[model samples]
Target: MNTFEKAAHFALTAHEGQIRKANPIPFILHPMEVAQIVSTMTHSQEVMAAAVLHDVVEDTSVTLEEVRETFGDRVAWLVEKETENKRHNLPAADTWQIRKEESLLDLKNCDDKDVQILWMADKLSNLRSFFRSRLRDGDRMWELFNQKDPEKQKWYYSKILELCDQLQDTTAYREYKILLKAIFSTDAINLQYQTGAFHFEV
Candidate 1:
């Protein structure tokens, strides 16, 4: 099998029995959706493989070494760029902001467009899920996440929109922006992005 196929199999095995938080959907579906989104942007196999494997190290017992050994350096590097240093000992809620801050800083500084593609793919999948849940559950949907406040969620997602502004031409980027506004309200999102007022501590 090719890199994307291998990574899909690896991810499926690693995420076995795991379901999305507060939803019954299988966890592998998230990575699958991300890979599909990444495909809409680029045909690079490494990037697509990385998208499928993005959460393995962060969410499973899989290691970077294992990924590198199996998939080679480039795919592993893409996966590493997508991974977060989740301070596993501490409460996830307590460490959420710091983790996101670090991720955003890295994305801001990274020159590679592939990294941005990976991030956009993953986040777009997340925002799509959020939009669907919001439609079905309304305000109560916020309670399902670690960062329950919609304002805090807005801050993180808006920063993503700002950081990925260079990708405005892509359909994925446009859809992501539309979903962000749909969930957060266009006026509020516009004000937050325009004024740089989304930096408050959660």
Candidate 2:
């Protein structure tokens, strides 16, 4: 099989029956969409492959060494850097600032543009989740977001900016940065981007 076929099969089998944290949507949708997003870029096969397998090492029983053996060292390394040990993920009450810092540090030391693409794609999934949550719970979530009582929305929204700041890709980051600005400026705009109602600025 070709690399793409191998990667797809690997991810599908690895993530079988899994779902997103707050949604019933299959978890594979994220990686699949992210890979699709990077397909708009050149020389991006590994970025696409890495996106499909991005969570395998971190969120699954899979290991980096095994991925290396399967997909080769480069793809394995991207997964390694992108996978954060949950000793790193914060509780909702804890500020996402710490998680943001870790990602920044990781981005700073990272030499691979491939990892950066994976990081941006990961945040794209995150922003998409915000829209999904808002839809499920309604503007009451927005009211709570404005009140900052529960702190979940604050953490999630700040992440959009933090991840945007960490992105070093001039072109893709610019595109996503525009999306972030639009998302923050108006709820209508946020929903527009989230629902594919708006086109990404070329």
Candidate 3:
């Protein structure tokens, strides 16, 4: 099988019985789409594999060691770095702070162009996703930050804009920005459960 196919199998088996807390979409699809999106930016097998197993540690019982044993050490390391700790029950602000720190650290260490491309692609995806979800219910999305929750909104967009500046490739950054802006005009490309996601005037 090709890279994408291999990645699909790896992610599917890893997330075999998991579901997204945000909704139900056979959790494997999330990583697969991330991997695919990253692939469009770089042909690096490492980044693609990282995208495939991105949530394995956080979403399933799978361990980093297990991923290394099955895929490879490099792939496992990237996956580990990108994994989110949603399992924690920290106060809202604390959790968001930790997550933000983790991502910023990892991105700072991303000297490799391929890695930066993947990271930027991931952030771009998140920004576009939230924008649509916001348009669907602006009040709820806006109110989410009333308690000063960093992850509530906008912070992600701001950080992503920063990451985009960190990107060494101008062309890639511009294209990604165009897509990020286009999200306001186009339908929520990746969202499934959220309807009226494009309520924001184009």
Top lDDT hit: 1
Error of 2 at 20 (Å): 1.0
- Clash count list over all predictions: 0, 0, 0
Q: Give the Cα-based TM-score of candidate 2 against the true structure.
A: 0.72
Please provide TM-scores, in order, for all candidate models, with all chains considered together: 0.90, 0.72, 0.71
Alpha-carbon runs more than 4 Å astray in model 2: 88-97, 139-175, 185-202
The candidate maximizing TM-score is: 1
C-alpha root-mean-square deviation, each candidate:
6.5, 5.2, 5.5
**Cα lDDT, all candidates:** 0.88, 0.67, 0.62
* lDDT of each residue in 1-202, candidate 2, tens digit only: 7676689899999999998765668998888877776665535666678888988987788989999999888888888878765553555336444555676677767656566667777776666665556545544444433234435444454554464454545555665656555444455555554574644443
Candidate with better TM-score, 1 vs 2: 1
Write down the TM-score for model 1: 0.90
Over the stretch 1-202, how does candidate 3's per-residue lDDT look in tens digits? 8655675687788788877433345777667767767877777777887887777787678888888887787777777767766636666555766676677777666665655666666665555555555555543543444234424344555555576565645554665565555443334533422554332222
Candidate 3 stretches greater than 4 Å from native = 2-4, 21-24, 85-93, 142-152, 164-172, 175-202
On the 0 to 100 scale, the lDDT of residue 197 in model 1 is: 43
Model 3 pairs in collision: none
Clashing pairs in 2: none
Task: Report residue 30 deviation for candidate 1 (angstroms).
Answer: 0.4
